[model samples]
Target: MLSLDYSKLLILAVVIAIVLFWPPKNKSFHRRGIDPGFLNLKVWPARIWFLLRGRNIVEQAYLQEKDAPYLLQSLNEDSLVLPPKYLPELRMLPGGKLSASEALVTSVLGQHSGVDVVLKDRQHYDIARVQLMRSLPTLVPILSAKVDSILSETLAACSTADFTHVKIKEIVSALVLRTTLLTFVGPELCENTELQWLVEEFTNIVRDMAIFLLFIPKFLRPVLWPVLPPTARMKRLHERVRRILFPKTEKNVKSSRDFPTVIDHFVATSEIVDEKEIVAKFLVLMAGALHTTKMSTSHAIIDLCASPECVDELRNEALAENLNDLPWHLDQVSCLKKLDSFLKESQRFNPPNYLSFDRIATSTFTLQDGTAIPKGTFISMAAGPMAMDPGYYEDAQTFSATRFCKTDESAVESGAEKSQWAHEFVSTESGNIHWGHGRFTCPGRWYASAVMKVVIAQILRKYEVKFPEGQRERLPNVYLDLIVEPNPKQVVRFRARE
Candidate 1:
């Protein structure tokens, strides 16, 4: 009976796949005035094969195009690949017309929870942008102290004289998540180990579930999602968070004093705040925050470990800042040019994703050069390939820790500030779309930058880090679909800096 049921479901899935991707007879690529490479029978199968072979389509686009648009297969439909030239016009379009959030929903089978908070709830994002991101300089003192304290506790288990093997992902994830919650949720939940662990578990549950579901088509998600392991874990985690956070949220809702976190700001702005829903929203925020920052921090550590000279240079720069007397804000963080450059170099070689500036056309729209896009078509800008392009940077393939920080003699003669390159970490200038482009860029990136630097600085100041026994080379990151992650099991040895 079980075998029979499995056979039936397999047949149903095959049928759905055929029906969903069935080529239309009348409206072919040529008839629609689009590139035929997208629909070519040979290309179609090869692109599908690329999915299994770990070949990324964005790299394909960057290598082929000069300044023209191309075609690629998206999760749900055919995507139009645009060059950087189209960014200004496409970014200027209203979200209702060219919607990235809707594209994300389609990409992830509508499983990206709290996407609405990011797209529809302007109030929530505005408060975050103004109160958290832009206010980073002011919040740095409080955030830095929390970060320093957490580092001590997290690394205390390790002995100082001998190298203690530690999984960089687990250690950095805990540190980033805790400090983020500290700054975003306040001391109550941040200090609570159980609550912090719950957030981390929830993040893992949702991330694993989302990545798994990204492979499932939109039509089949409802039927298949319930059976996935992460689904059950996500539900239990959500309930646990709700039970823990409800009373705290209630107290804040009724409180008179203004709090420093984004949650306090959100509660103040919202008209009828449901505690359960708010908890879920916070989960979304943390999930989004934890994964990207954690991975970036891990990658930076990996790079630093691989090159001890880079570590010494960054540490020397950090020590020269005399950060104790300064306010330890954006301006203060900005002075650590080598640290900033090292992080950017790591990001350049291993970005968070292969694609960026993804959007779905809500209505039939034409590009500046008159290429028409159907209402339902998806589009994305190449991020990873653009960063790796030799046209953009000298020796693009090699890792240079001060690639961005190093200034030429011409700059000195021209009176350009050497510190200008620090913005590369967060800004989207010269086709650097990691943070994204225009108004749709990650609003919380400034805060994320500050948090990352603080944690890295604290680690450098207190402890020494290096790759574990016989593992001199940094572990290669894995690319699944569009997500990039550092090696989870790769251990780093840490000891107290003498």
Candidate 2:
């Protein structure tokens, strides 16, 4: 008997989330070695080891030892990882000459053979981001409509009430999927289930393949990359994408098409590259925006459900600002200051991976404290440590939604220097806590911020979420083989509020 009850599923999910998050018993899993070869082979084992030890890789090794503001270490460029303090020096060759961003991407995808953006430096990332971000302020209505449709469709198949819980993941997944499809394939194709399913599957295949592919020998990688099943699916997704792309092949592509999506801009301005190359960009665009954005937002929703104080403030802000009935304007997105505060607090407490940015020296460079890092080196900030470090943020590991708020309040009270806390929150120009300081940071940051705001607002306005009775806040343990990612999955419930 296939007894399917979503509430039960949510209960099981909460259990799973707890298990995934429960600190492991090993501490060395979080420690670093200088070789990518060592990481690729033993990432899982290391994660398990570190989980048992209760120390992240960095915490177990360098971070614990360094009492000075910063210190010199013998770790070299190709080390699979580097300690936190050396990150800035590792960002560029001395004098801001050569960047280390290239090394990070190359390490992830295994080959720069295809991503032209990698070869072009920050220019390509910036242009693509500008095009995408410039289009967001206009997408408010389109995104709202898509969200409603996803909710209606998702709830249509569900049954939840006061005594029941709903596996919020499916509902949220539906929301993310529909919104992404609208942007990627345009509304006409987006509403098509067949196409949307294909796109979602294609995304899943690429990510899973990436995880598995990293284990293959470097020599075998180049030879095997093309033979992977995900590569074949990518070709098909691309072929379909090209069919959708050709109409705007610059003949009459408008700067702002009715939808103004990545596909609209790509075929409109740039010379046509290889079909695979174009597909790769589109795939990356979808994956980049949806995966991280959805995961973070979903977790936030769960956190809010767990903390009614946070949710009540968010709901009041959204309703007070006329968010419910109005189209999602940029102002509406911005008015949720408390919501933003809550989001930042969540990130502070549970960063994607106990680390954020990646850097590798192109040449030898010295730290602010006079430590020399050899050229072509790798390093990442201790995300868990940095965000948790009281030196930078008070009560570093605690969730203080009003922590930055206090900064703003103090500025207002002084009536001298106005608080730019929110501005700093939104501004990538100043770059904080390793969101890839400066230009090489994720180009899609603005788009990401917008989506997060919309989703949070939507949830706050419509649902009352809460953790199961007696459950506690869960902070994930991230294991970075390449980059930081949230631990596997979490389960939580959402019920429509009257």
Q: Which candidate should be chosen as best, given TM-score against the real structure?
A: 1
TM per candidate: 0.81, 0.75
Error of 1 at 304 (Å): 0.5
Candidate 1 has which clashing residue pairs, if any?
none
Residue 347 in candidate 2, Cα distance off native in Å:
1.0
Alpha-carbon lDDT, every model: 0.70, 0.57
Model 1 per-residue lDDT at 327: 32
227 Cα displacement, candidate 2 (Å): 4.2
Which numbered prediction scores highest in lDDT against the true structure? 1
Off by over 4 Å in 2: 1-55, 66-101, 112-117, 120-124, 157-164, 202-204, 207-216, 224-233, 244-257, 363-370, 408-419, 423-434, 469-472, 475-489
RMSD to native for every prediction? 6.4, 12.5
Model 1, position 317: C-alpha lDDT score: 72
Q: With candidate 1 superimposed using the best TM-score fit, by how many Å does residue 298's alpha carbon deviate from the native? A: 0.5
In model 1, state the lDDT of residue 72: 57
- Any idea what lDDT model 2 has? 0.57
